[model samples]
Target: MNPPSLSFRARARLSRSAGALLLATAGLASLAGCANYAGIRSDKQPLDVARIDTAQSLPTQGGQWPTMNWAADFGDTQLSSLIAEALANNPSIAEARARLDRAAAYAAGADARRYPRVDGHYSVKRELYSGNALYPEPYGGSWYTENNASLSASYELDLWGKNSAGLAQAISEQRASAAEEQESRLALATSVAQQYNALAREYALFDVAQAEARERQALGQISAARFSAGLDTQVETRVSDTQIATSNTLVSQLQGSITVMRYQLGALLGKGPDRGLAIARPQMQPLPVSALPDNVPANLLSRRPDIVAARWRIDAATQGVTIGKADFYPDINLSAAAGFDAFGFGHFLQFGSRQIQVGPAIDLPIFDAGALRARLKDRYATFDTAVATYNDTLVRALTEVATQIAQIRSIEQQQHDAQAAYDAAAKAYQLAVIRYQGGLSTQLQVLDADRALLQQRQTLVTLASQRRDQQIGLIKALGGGFDSAPPPRRDALDAMTSPT
Candidate 1:
């Protein structure tokens, strides 16, 4: 024990260890700094400069806009009027507009989250007191009332850009919804135009049927006269009567279809079925004489509203991941409260009653049994889904463009061939009628030729209408004319048009 006592100073020197601990702590802090910096940069990198360019090759470029005025594009005033009515009254449009309003309002609210929150409140309370203890002599209880008023304030400091991310996500969603509304508009316009074209074709067919019926009725009268004169058989008169009956039935069916079309048009304009909405038949405008562009798919991303909406979805998901990850870290917030409190109303504003406090509050997540981790996992999965959906939408959009292009071209050729057939059939029918009158061909053969002519004409009309419909489809698949709109303003329309 005497020998160990001599080593006290040496033992104290050997036990000193704070220098090593300081060095280790510094190294760990450096590593954390590097990790945090890397993460912030990573979050920012993915969102830089994400935009699509337009190409002259996209069919949407053929028109200045997605033909939001599709009916007017066809040069029909009646159709334009109907479209206007539909836009004003359609339930879907109204719903979309309301949703847009709500989104704008929410975006405004979200933006306000970045600012301090202030609230004023007043309260009144009554207290009952009993004095029966050793320090007091009173044995009765008395009630008292007090009133206090205060203004409190709270604000979360966006230390890690969490509030910014949330706001961005909300704004992006608003933009996507607006794009969806545009998509719906384009779809509705296409439907109206297509249905109008169909109605017109039906009318053309009706005209042909009525003409044929009139001719057949005249022929039936002649057959009846001939049969009475012993020149034609009852079987021939019956055949004429049967043809007339068939043509009359067809006319009736076509008339019913027209009525149905009128009802449909009225419904599109948000009117009751019996509103007697009149849809004047839209005659076919001449086929587009402009040259068609060939072989480009890149512009579909920029021109289509659905494509824009999908991209916005991806942006929103990306922002969501950021916000979720931020939750894993500490939340820095600033809160303040100021108020007046006193036992009497006269003393409420006194110096002793005045109170004010302000401070920063930090919330650190120490443990939640993996709750934050699971939420982060879910958000990442959601981001992945968004990415996949965006890619799929792009692929589908390209495919639609290609398919529509092919359809348009094929319909064009079909229209040409049908026109030739109609011309030849018309000439042949005329010649057959002349030949039959001159006793070179039978009346039955002339009737057959006339029917053939009508069929050929109807086929031509249908092919032409199909081409029109396909053109509209191609425009839609290519993303319409959103690009043609001026760049969005930063304030008023920002919530609607911005990628949040």
Candidate 2:
């Protein structure tokens, strides 16, 4: 016998059950066809500060990180002002700032993806119907106008954390850009200070050259008098004239170098060469001796802008890997639309012309010739590269600090020895001049003493310049007074991918 006819309520219940069964079967089939991403992962890891050997080069006590106004310690107000100007107007600084803004904009865009997207659309068209096939009677061969207006909305379920991971990645990149901007500022400021120090060295050498020239002119006069009294030959006067000419040439070279240095300083200040001309002679005090701060490599991660930027990039790459993994799962979206459609304007707003749709859309990643696997592999590789770069930056930063410290120490000793030598040479030149006047020594002896004194003076000036330069180098290596909190730990990053 045929089954009994079902009541309306029973038929409705039966229909609901069938729909649920169909949806469940489809979900299982989708899961069975999903692409596998089991073993593809990044193996690279960041370097541990404790594992790297510091070799006792960096002192772990009695030191502090450089202050923001570390340049003031050099007692040069002009240098500080120039650094400030460069930070404000340098093209590199501007570029970095623009990049930061771009990254922030990208981050904002990514954030917007987490919320529902709504769009409004309207269109009108006039068309002629064919007299064959689907059209019939009066409708056939008739011209009609169509109107459509829709308001549609969609929201991703984010069950697999794809949207969240993407937002996190964008935020990390924004932070990295911020750190890089600071890095640019530090580089520009240090450059200005180093160039200014070089300019001061040149000026000091110029003064010595001018004094030597005056002494050579006096000696030339003495040689001419001796030759006229038959005490010396024309050879002596000619040698004295050559020495005076050499001194004048040195003075001229120093003057030219000073001008070039000023031009360079002007460029660093983001101005024309004329701007550098306005810079006054630097009245720098003695270079202050500084020791390395405590914690050595451990604190360097936060102290160095480059290192901080690298770390942030690694965080961004980590999020990229999360996003890649998320792609292997299903993407479900809830979408709804309400609209009006009509053949003519008379019926466009009528209730009978209203249309509505609401449903969940699912996108399953099935077989695609290994495209998904390849994408995941690329993300893993990118993560590995970011980790490697961070490691390299850390090692390089530590090496720079150690190298500058060694140089500074060596320069200090050299400066001490050079000062003593300069004092002795000065006394010897004085004695040689008195002896020559008393006819106890030859003109050649005074000339030799004068050459020794000039050589010593030049050495002293060069060492002083080197000391100042290395001091600046050490400051830069120590992160140029950059200070910031450390990036989020690994656990924090993992928390981002966890479901709410």
Candidate 3:
């Protein structure tokens, strides 16, 4: 369509209409920012299925995530000690704590912006005047200097809640930052647990390798003796040597694994990975037989710190929209200055010399074509992005819970099957050995049965280890019972105790 040309009055009317529309749009955008219509829907959809009752909650019991002491769950005192050390000295945790402090300070500053800013001032000077002075003049000059000092104070009245919105946004960001720090802590603790478990498994593997190597050495000696007596062939002796060599090679590989794990443990504890800390070999805990909670997936909203952080980000974005729209309206600020004024510093302390001033100032945007329009659009887009992010995080959290549940169930079945197989193969190996001694079975048959039994045993051990690790992962994913802790009442940023 072609644009229409207009007379002066018509253009003025059109401009006013356009301004009104822009202001209206900006106001709507602000509403959109403060309220997460999309997030509410998303949150509600899950709540219907999960039956979440936020209002009916009780205080956390003693075994809650924050209070439970996860290390104690494993019955490992050494693991507990290591975790304590990591919490105290880990660089990442320290950095996160510093950031929390910074965020809290920023929130405080934002809040204080709404209050009056007061300051004291003082000055002293000799006067020189170019023009004739009513009282006295030191010299006739083109320039004049005089001393006057006064204390001043100013305040911006948040008539439209703009300052309030700004403070709210800062507070939301502070909460988000705190949640992020807790997430980091959970990640750090999980890494330490996983690494410690890996080290234990490697140590077990090393022990297994050593035992196999000794067995192979004994078989090799027996074969050598038999060959010298002309009862075994040279090929049998060669096979025994090969077996011994393979077993020794495996032992060496396991030793290498032990060294690497030791270095990693050292690094995780914030010691130099290679040389700062001694590698104290820890006793591995037996696999936990505890059953997982049936309502694990439903508890994610309460447990996951990242999800909570995302929601706070959404709230902050919403408040940002409100603040942006408020900008398009007239700003009302109340400023006042009150101070003692005197010709000399000695009179500054006298109340009679004080001068007081007070007034309200209004800033009306007369002709900034579309600056506020553009800003409102930007805030709308940011709000949309925050909503999207929140939805995405919610989906991921659900998937995590489901995945851990499935993994744990599957590993349990695999462990059971592996145990049965190991038992059967062990019996077969015993029979084969007895037959070989009676010259009824070949050495190869005995070897095959023994290898099968070893394979089953190794698979069971690996599966058991994996099952334990998965349990730890599931607990970590569920925010490790940290959700049971009460939220902070203070505006100051506190250490986050959320899940990763």
- TM match of model 2 to true structure: 0.91
Model 1: per-residue Cα lDDT over 395-451, one tens digit each = 677667667767887888887888889899989988886775455776688778878
Mark the regions of model 2 whose C-alpha exceeds 4 Å error after superposition.
Answer: 1-34, 228-230, 491-500
The best candidate by TM-score is: 2
Candidates in order: C-alpha RMSD to true structure: 11.3, 5.6, 11.8
Which lDDT tens digits does candidate 3 get at residues 1-500? 11123459865776776576557545554453332222111111112324433222311222233333776677678887887788788999999999889989989999999888877665666655645655344445544333455666777757667899899989988988888787888888888888888887887777777877886686677668767877779998899888889989999998888888888888889888763247577676765554544454445555788877877777787677678756755565555555555655666556556665555555655446666657766776776676677678877776665576568779999988888898899899788867755557766886788678767867876887788788778767778655733232222111111101
* TM-score against native, each model: 0.80, 0.91, 0.79
List, residue by residue over 1-500, the lDDT tens digit for candidate 2.
Answer: 11234569866876786576459546844684468677675556788778999958776866778878989989989888989998988999999999999999999999999999998888999999888959996988999999998888999888778899999999999999999998999899999999999999999999999999999999999888888888889999999999999999999999999999999999999999999999999988776676778887888889899999999998998888788878877777778777888999999887778776566667777888899889978887878788899999999999999999999999999999999999999999999988887778999899999999999999998999899999999999999889888787675234333322
On lDDT, the stronger of 1 and 3 is 3
Question: Which is the leading candidate under lDDT?
Answer: 2
Q: lDDT per model, in order?
A: 0.67, 0.86, 0.68
The lDDT, on a scale of 0 to 1, for candidate 2 is 0.86
